[model samples]
Target: MARIKPQALLIQSKKKKGSTRVSLATIITCNILVILVLLSLYATYNHFYKRPTSQLGEELMNTENTKDGGAVKKFDLPGYAIIETSKGSITVELHKDSSPEFVDKFLDLCQKGYFKGMLFHRVIKHFFIQGGDPHYLRAAEGWTLQGKSNGQLSTSLNSPKHEAFMLGTSKTKPNAKGFEIFITTAPIPELNDKLNVFGQVIKGEEIVQEIEEVDTDEHYRPKSPVEIVNITLKHEP
Candidate 1:
């Protein structure tokens, strides 16, 4: 090339540097825009497709522990029981804090299989269903079964109400050989505190309703026997 002017060379050098700087700035801006678009896509995917960890945890906890308006109250008992009847199964959570002794005794009876094969002998429609009468299971066993009374009352804060699906001990007469139990189909406020509410039907209100609506005789005994097939305990995990 022919000799170039020094001033022209300097001007060309400055213009080349400016072009390079502009190219670098343009590249940086494009990279920043791409990163922003990727971040927005990720946020939208999480919002629509993925459930938050906190919400999932909350739902799981609710499944494990729940309270119903007309059924079982929320409780953290040591264990629960499943009463398998001819109709279906009824899951109940015992009220240990209020009636610890009664709950222990009830669990002990369940462990001994005392309730197996017993019939839901008495079922008052829209009122209650009674069972656990050994006399009905084994009349020759010399057990004296009697109707429950309201002599005993509790004042503890944890004493469960005689609401729908509440499990209460059927108080027998003095010197009775065996015990009885009843489950309310409706809120019997008169029985509140008068009867010992030891448990609540948590997951089997539908089963209870089925038993309650069954045909009964004039004596309130179920026409078709509703037998207690088994009683199983579920301990805390």
Candidate 2:
């Protein structure tokens, strides 16, 4: 208006056009941001608010099984037995809901004082200690039989896995486990998913180590005996 130069007027026009373009871009960007926020809210609602327990259950469950899916139904197990080895004492909790038949068979043997004076017959250093075979029991003067005829056997495809408590398991052979419990010293990854770990040793891990160190000939039977004075079931609930 004040007799602006022609060049200056042209520059002013360009500046106004640039501002219009910037304003349009800002509006478009804000609209996009709003849309993203709405989509996020919708997705969250669909995933959490609208999802059912059945769906959530699948995520938390360890196995693909649903409803009597071989999962421990009781939600919790009872810590009941104490295996006091010469090295120390180990506590074990039993799972009836997960494997009541197995637990009962083991408990029956314990109640019978079957493990008294039994040697930890087999030892795989840093892997496990397997006993429970009546073969090692100091029975007056005869070989002890191991089977349902004289003793119980585990037919489970996978032994209940537990790092705390030792458990009896099989290795491809039928009725191969009797009074045998192996302690997992290292995490055996190959055994994962394929084996069922049932118990863990809460105490007396040192005993397991001590038992492992005992010099063995060939069968892993300790030259010296690792005796279980007695295994008493405590706090069944």
**Which candidate wins on TM-score?**
1
lDDT of each: 0.74, 0.60
lDDT of 2 by residue, 105-205 (tens): 67778888878887677665645566666552332112112221243233333533533235544333335444455565544433443234556666666
Taking all chains together, each candidate's TM-score versus the true structure is 0.56, 0.50
lDDT of 2: 0.60
Model 2 poorest ten-residue lDDT run = 139-148
Task: Put down candidate 1 lDDT per residue, 83-128, tens digits, no spaces.
Answer: 9999999999887778887887888888899999998888876567
